[model samples]
Target: MQQIEFQLEHEFVELNQLLKLVGLCDSGGAGKALVATGEVCVDGTQELRKTAKIRAGQRVRMGDVEIQVGSST
Candidate 1:
């Protein structure tokens, strides 16, 4: 599996935006579509909410990619 580290600039980040920020998708809309397909997971469980608030220390996964969110220092 591929691993990526993401540092949040605020309290949280929207799921679709995160996907876009990490280069997983071309845009937030595309990320939403991908999430709607039920292919994304959060903390090992399926995530269907495209705008789910993702905070620091949370893990988001899709296919072979895993994004590790961290709080900005």
Candidate 2:
């Protein structure tokens, strides 16, 4: 699995944006499609919200890529 630590600049990041930030997809649209098709997970539960509010300490996984959200220091 590929691990990515993403430092949030705000209280949260949109799900699709996070996917792109972590290099999981080529674009935001692609990320949305992946989420819509139920290919993403948040904290071990399947997440279908394309614009889900993903805050710090959250873990998002898609296939072999996993992104760990962290607060910006």
Candidate lDDT scores, in order, read 0.98, 0.92
Worst 10 residues of 2 by lDDT: 17-26
TM-score of every candidate: 0.98, 0.93
- Tell me the tens digit of each residue's lDDT in model 1 across 22-46: 9999999999999999999999999
Clashing pairs in 2: none
Distance (Å) between predicted and true CA of 24, model 2? 1.2
Give the runs in model 1 whose Cα sits over 4 Å from its true position.
none
lDDT (Cα, tens digit) per residue for candidate 2, span 1-73: 9899999999999999898888778999998999999989999999998999999999999888889999996
Give me the displacement of residue 26 in model 1, in angstroms: 0.4
